[model samples]
Target: MLYIVSALKPEAQAFVDHYKLKKSKLNNFTIFSNYNIRLIISGMGVENARLATQTLINNFDITDDDTYLNTGICGASRSYTIGELIECGGVNYNGIDHIFQENRPIISCVSEEVATPSYELADMESYGFYDAVIHNPAIKQFHIIKVVSDHFEPQKVGKEETKSLLFNVIDDINKIINF
Candidate 1:
């Protein structure tokens, strides 16, 4: 089984609607389904994202063979154009670098340690998820897929605007995930 997480309903809905997914409420959590996929809409930010992902892992009793994907929009360095989908070559947690771009979709790096040399852009829970899941040998692989949503301005991206940004980048996302 593929385990997928999106930070908001809209992001989850993008795949849900596209696939004509059905909604189910298990316990108190919401679940959406595709033929071979199970999606959880873990609310925005890192704490919520972490909790939601953990919940999915616990509820489904996920094993090592499953793939965990944290999919959503993120801030990009100025070098990345808005609306581009990037399979994270690495993650810069605060400032500590962890490179994961072994053989996936590649992104040009600005420096040896920096994955993308943008200013501090925040996505709630990817680092924790990466750190937690990658240790499991049963898991074949895990990576983050992010789309450029905002440059540096908060006002530049509100909720509605983010969904719009996500919609525009969905095709690129498709290629990124399946690539």
Candidate 2:
């Protein structure tokens, strides 16, 4: 089973459409799931990401075979163009870092975007997602894939733009999941 966690409805739309996933209500959260795949939208924030991830994993019988992935669009430094795919290798939350062994790894500073620094990536959700899931005894894989959306400018981000940014990396996300 593969579980893809997203932060917004737009971020998850491509996968839901591509996979023909069926929507089921779990509490107030919308879960898009098929036989072997589940996509949960955490709704943009550290606390929401943590709570939503914990809720979904708790409600389901996650096993070693299942893979948990957090997929979304992020605010990045101007050096990275919009719509670039980044497979986060590490995440920093409240100055604490969680490093991973992966390809093209970048550090994601998970927090509300204010003045985006030169960090590889910045988002409001990844740290919370990783923080909560790391405690789970699922004994398997977890990855973070984010598409560059804003150049550290929150005013430039909108729902339509987020959808477009996420669309650019759906193929990369598909490859990651298949691999």
User: Against the correct fold, how does model 1 do in TM-score?
Assistant: 0.76
Model 2 CA RMSD to the hidden true structure, in angstroms: 1.9
Cα-lDDT of candidate 2: 0.81
lDDT of 2 at 137: 71
lDDT of candidate 2 over 10-129, digit per residue (tens): 888878877899999888899999998888989888889988888878888978788888888887777788888888888877777778764556556555665656566788898878
Residue 73's lDDT in candidate 2: 82
lDDT of 1 by residue, 1-179 (tens): 66777877766777776668789875556889766678788765555666666777667766655678888776656777787777776665656677777654332212222244445444555665665566555666566887777664545676766677777766776565562
Model 1, C-alpha of 103: deviation from truth (Å): 8.4
lDDT for model 1, please. Answer: 0.65
lDDT scores in order: 0.65, 0.81
RMSD of each: 5.1, 1.9
